[model samples]
Target: MRLLSMITLALAFSPFAISQDPTTQSKIADATQDVVPSETSTQPLDFWMQKKLDYSTAILRGLAFSDFDLIETNANQMRMLNKIEGFVRNRNPEYRGHVHAFERVTDEVIRQAKQENIDGVTLAYHQLTVSCVRCHQSLREAE
Candidate 1:
């Protein structure tokens, strides 16, 4: 307990633990604003997951109403998210592979929508859902 307390006290006064210089702090804040939101520590890990749910739900809504525009829009969002995932670069190859699969499935979804092929869209969506589930499962197993 004494050693831990001494270490804690040492860290408390450490340069990284406390900002003694106001100018340095302001500079840090200014630099932070230029970073990608996803690269920021303020972003929650599940933030991307929430986006996935939203876009996927929107795609479902499109299917329910036979709205090709909605389907394409959501699929485009998914493709964008996939690109972001690439930029974020999950070092786990499994996650990386799933990201690629997501892009391919999303492309298929957009293509099906463009062709006005509801059946093809439905099939592609099933594949996309399966891909998402499998990716999540792999992550869980890794954990």
Candidate 2:
């Protein structure tokens, strides 16, 4: 009985148990591999932008398959990028607004991913893309 209880408890808390399905794990691995940069890359923008694009692609793939684990992994990556020093450093007021909007939308994506809400995640992802476009346009106009 004690052995049975221990096995049950271990299964409940194990990361492997949570994502134990081979198909799901494969999708997650494939999606992650699609975006991660080679070790030699050093530019912050290049790293973050690649990650952003990778995560966006992962999210779409996850949505197609109803793979919440893939969505959560990529959403967490986006949230991690929000903490990067370069991502937060902006002196221009308009650009700062765009940054804040991006952060907020990314947070929403993370939240929705955690909740496994496909519609919410999709909506937040769209908002994040719009924020990126708006920020880029502002930068071009400034230049």
Candidate 3:
């Protein structure tokens, strides 16, 4: 219930507004501290996990196909999601720590992808996967 409430509040005041006009874009930076990509800013978290999963899968495909564009794009998207998620959550120290850790890994992945370093990107992806698992465990423990 609390998670649902938080989602509602985030969307209500967030860049998730239907149109990404100057006002909506401004509000996004106010809380999430980043420019949420206008294309995806409107989707609520209720259905956003699917997009996250899709992006993750695309990252893997990019690795397999040696597509730097795909990998960098998706990695950047994940970073944005991480920022929005941090604000939409309870904002305790522990939660913020998890967000920061994920953001670090996401940045690493983006950097490696841009450099076309498959080995580096693979290592960073492993770290990102582990971060996801740890954060999920923490969330369960909190509940």
* Residue 96 CA displacement from its true place in model 3, Å: 0.8
Q: Per-residue lDDT tens digits of candidate 1, residues 1-143?
A: 35334433543465643653665444433433322235336767576677778889999999999999789767866665565555465758888888899889999999999998999999999999999999889988989
lDDT of 3 by residue, 1-143 (tens): 56545554665575444456676355544634332322235765444456567768989999999998788777866777777667666457888998999899999998999899999999998999999899879888988
Task: Using lDDT, give the best candidate's number.
Answer: 3
Model 3 gets an lDDT of 0.73
Q: lDDT per residue, candidate 2, 1-143, as tens digits?
A: 35334433543455843654776555544543443333334645466567777778988888889788777777755654443322334648887787678878888887897888989988988898898899889988999
TM-score between model 1 and native: 0.70
Clashing pairs in 2: none
Give the count of colliding residue pairs in each prediction: 0, 0, 0
Model 1 clashing residue pairs (backbone):
none
Evaluation by TM-score, superior candidate among 2 and 3: 3
Q: lDDT of all the models against the reference?
A: 0.73, 0.67, 0.73
C-alpha TM-score for every candidate? 0.70, 0.63, 0.68
The better-scoring model by lDDT among 1 and 3 is: 3
TM-score of 2: 0.63
Best by TM-score: 1
